[model samples]
Target: MIILGIDPGIADTGFGVISAEKSTFKAITYGTIKTSKADDLAKRLDYLYKDIEKLIKKHKPSKIGIESIFFAKNAKTAITIAHARGICLLAAQQAKAQIHEYTPLQIKQALTGYGAADKNQIQQMVKTILNLKEIPKPDDAADALACAICCAQTKQYV
Candidate 1:
């Protein structure tokens, strides 16, 4: 199964693609979609939408796993992230891929066997699970890959 995982944000949306077979997961591609700071919020979102659509078309993933929105102390940041996440979900729906959502706690637990695992612990697990030399760059991209790993791990039980 090919799974695309997304960690959405207005400025830097993270994306990771992985292929899973027989309980083994391999990272295909991972990166961040960055929008210029000079661009307005609407323009940034438009860029994100188009880029995500292209990514979906190119990868043709069987499913998409995205991190659920976690409440933030800054309501404005949370609202903006919610909008970005909505567009990502829409892109997955349009591509007709099965969509799965996981929380940060769930992803950490799946990857590290600890629900309250720190970011470094999760990154280390992601690196070890995929047999990569180092953690993927940009914390968001690592988190996105972790989300994909979580989905791959839970697929059998679900």
Candidate 2:
């Protein structure tokens, strides 16, 4: 099964594509879609939606896993993230992909067996699980991969 994972943000949205079969996982691609802060919110969201839609079209993933907002530093930050996440969901829905939402705690616990796992732990787990030569870079990409792994590890998929 092809699965797409997303770590959404207004400035840099991370994405990972994986093919999962039983207990095996192969990384198809992973990267970040970046938007310039110089642009206004509307422009940035437009760019985000278009890029995400392109990814969905290219991958044709059967399932999409997205990170849900668990905590935010401020109301503004939470609102912005909600906007970005909404775009992600819309893109997934438009593609008719089965969407699964995971909170940060859920993703961390799924990957590391501990809900309080640190970033480095999750990154290492993502690398080790996929047997990648090195950790997925830029932090966000790793987090997206972790989300994918979590989704894939779910009993329904396994």
Candidate 3:
């Protein structure tokens, strides 16, 4: 089964694709969609919407795992990220992918068995779980993979 994971941000939306078979997961492709800060919020959102749709078309994932809004230091930052997340959700729905949301705590616990695991710990766990030679870069991508792993580890996939 193929699962697409997303770590949404207005400026950098991270995406990771993983193929899961039974207890093992294979890393597929992962990257971030970056939008310029110069772009207005509306334009950025539209860009994200189109880009996410294109990604769904290209990957044809069976499921989507997205990180939910968690504690943020800045309200504006959180709201902007939420906009990007909404686009991801719309793309997933349009592509008929089963959508699941996990909080940062849930993702952390699922990947590292510690709900309060730090970013470095989660990244290392993501690397270890996917059996990759190196940790996925750009942090966002690694987080996305962690989201995918969280989804895969839960309830049996049909």
Candidate 4:
């Protein structure tokens, strides 16, 4: 199955696409969607919506795995991310893709067997899981790949 994973952010939304069979994952593509702070919030969200929609149309993923929102230190920042996340959920729904949301801790634990695993540890696991030469780039894309790996392990396609 082609699984599309997303780590949503207002400024830089990370996305990764991978093919999964049972527990094995092979990376297809990974990148970030950057939005300008100079643009209005609505325009930024619209850009995200359009870009994500394009990705779905391009990849035709069977399902989507998204990182769920957790408590953030900055309330305003959290709210901003929630907006981006909302657009992602909306896009998946509109595409008729099965959606699964995972918490950061759940993703870490699934990949590393430890919920408290740090970013480097989780990225290392992602690298190993996908059999990549290095951790996926730009941190956020690696995080999205990790979320996909978690769902690939925990969720059964059949």
Which candidate wins on TM-score? 2
Q: Answer with 1 or 2, whichever has the higher TM-score.
A: 2
Candidate 2 has which clashing residue pairs, if any?
A: none
lDDT per residue for candidate 2 within 1-158, as digits (tens), equals: 99999999999999999999999998999999999999999999999999999999998999899999999999999999999999999999999999999999999999989999999999999999999999998899998999899889876543
lDDT values, one for every candidate: 0.91, 0.94, 0.91, 0.92
Error of 3 at 78 (Å): 1.7
What is the Cα-based lDDT of residue 9 in candidate 3?
92
Global fold similarity of model 1 (TM-score): 0.96
- Name model 2 segments beyond 4 Å from true: 156-158
TM-score to true structure, per model: 0.96, 0.97, 0.95, 0.96
Task: Write one digit per residue (lDDT tens) for candidate 4, span 41-106.
Answer: 999999999999999999999889999998898999899999999999999999999899999999
Separately for all candidates shown, the number of backbone clashes (residues 3 or more apart, or on different chains) is 0, 0, 0, 0
TM-score of 2: 0.97
TM-score for candidate 4, please give it.
0.96
* Residue pairs with clashing backbones, model 1: none
| Candidate numbers, best TM-score first, in rank order | 2, 4, 1, 3
Consecutive 10-residue window with the lowest summed lDDT within model 4: 149-158
